[model samples]
Every structure is written in C-alpha cells, then in structure tokens.
Target: MVKVRLWGSLRQAAEGQTEVEVEARTFKELLDRLVETYPGLAPQIARGVSLSLDGVIYREAWFTEIRPESEVVLMPYMTGG
Candidate 1:
C-alpha cells in the first residue's frame, strides 16, 4: 500500500484524513483505488487533481510509476494563463 497525503478539499472528501493508503503501482491505479475506496473523492478526481511524487508535481501523468517509499501528495489541479 502506498500512503498519500491529502491537501485542501481532498481531505474533506477523504473523511477528514490528512493521509491515506491505497494499493497502487502507478498514477492511474492510485486514482482508481482512491475513488474505489472513497466514493466521495470521485467527483474531484474526475475533474482533475495534481500529484506530488517525491517532491515533483505532475498533472495528468497517469502512467507515472510510484515507489512504495516515495512521498505522495494529492491536491487540486493548478492552471495559469
């Protein structure tokens, strides 16, 4: 299981959890497992979210490999003009 830190509204959807764990080997699997485990997180995940893997933030990076020991965080997607 990979541990993920929640940020902003994600914590609310995750039953007020700041951190949670899920079984995932890749970004896609991680998001899938999140929605499966926490139905409340579905809508926000569908809209889009950013991922921070070991200090690197990524957007829409579905296949990114995640290590068990890597730091992972989920936050709202960011956009700039």
Candidate 2:
C-alpha cells in the first residue's frame, strides 16, 4: 500500500483523515482507488489536484509509476495571480 497524504478540502472530504493507504501501481490507479474508497472526493479530484510522489509534484502525470512504499501527497491545485 502506498502512503497518501491529504490536504485542504481533500482532508475534509475524506472525513478529516490526514493520511490513507491505498493499493496502486500507477498514479491513475491511485486516484481511481481514492475516489472509489471515498466517493465524496470524486468531484474535487476530477476538478483538479496536485500529486506529490516521492517528493516530486505532478499536476497531470497519470502514468507515473507508484510503488507500494511510495510517499504520496494529494492536495487541491493552487493558483496565484
């Protein structure tokens, strides 16, 4: 299982859980599993979120490989003007 950290509204949507464990081999699978496990996160996730894999952040690199022990962080997208 990969370790996933949630932030902002994602945490609130996930019932205030800061972290979760999920089984996935790729980034896309991770997102799918997260939404499956927590249906409420679907809308936010679909709108857009940033993913951090082993300290690297990705906006839409779904094909990124995720190992069982990968450190992952999922958070809402940030924009600055």
Candidate 3:
C-alpha cells in the first residue's frame, strides 16, 4: 500500500482526509484506485493535479513506480498569478 497525502482542494474532495492508503504499483494505478475508493475526487482529479513522490513533484509521470513505503502527495495544479 502506498501512502497518499491530499492537499488543498484535493483534501476537500476526499472528505477532509489528509492521508489515504492505496494499493498500486504505478502512479496511474494509484489514481485509478483513489477515484474508485473516493468517487468525490474524480471531478477534482479530472481537472488536473500534481503528484509528489518522495519529495519530487511530477505532473505527467503516469508510469512512475510507487512502492508500498513511498511518500506520495496529491495537490491541485499550482499556478502563478
């Protein structure tokens, strides 16, 4: 199981949960499982989000490998005004 930390709006979508556990081998699979477990997150996820794995941020790394102990964080896309 991977530990996923939800931030900002993503946390709101997940019913205020800051952390969640999911079983997946890859980043893409994690997202799939997340949406499956938390249907409310689908719309926010579809809008676009950034992922941080072991402190490294990724935007389009769907194939990134994720281990059971990996530290993962999910947050809404960041932009500058």
Worst 10 residues of 1 by lDDT: 72-81
lDDT of 3: 0.90
Instruction: Compare the candidates by lDDT and give the number of the best one.
Output: 1
Q: Write the per-residue lDDT of candidate 2 for residues 1-45, one digit (tens) a residue.
A: 898999889998888899999889888999999999998999999
- In the range 1-81, model 3's lDDT, one tens digit per residue, is 888999998888888899999999987898899999999999988988889999999987899999888889999889999
CA-lDDT, candidates in order? 0.96, 0.91, 0.90
> Candidate 1 residues 2-80, lDDT tens each?
9999999999999999999999999999999999999999999999999999999999999999999999999989768
TM-score of 3: 0.94
Best of the two (1, 3) by TM-score: 1
Model 2 segments more than 4 A misplaced: none
Sort by lDDT, best first. Answer: 1, 2, 3
Error of 3 at 58 (Å): 0.4
The whole-model C-alpha lDDT of candidate 2 against the native structure comes to 0.91
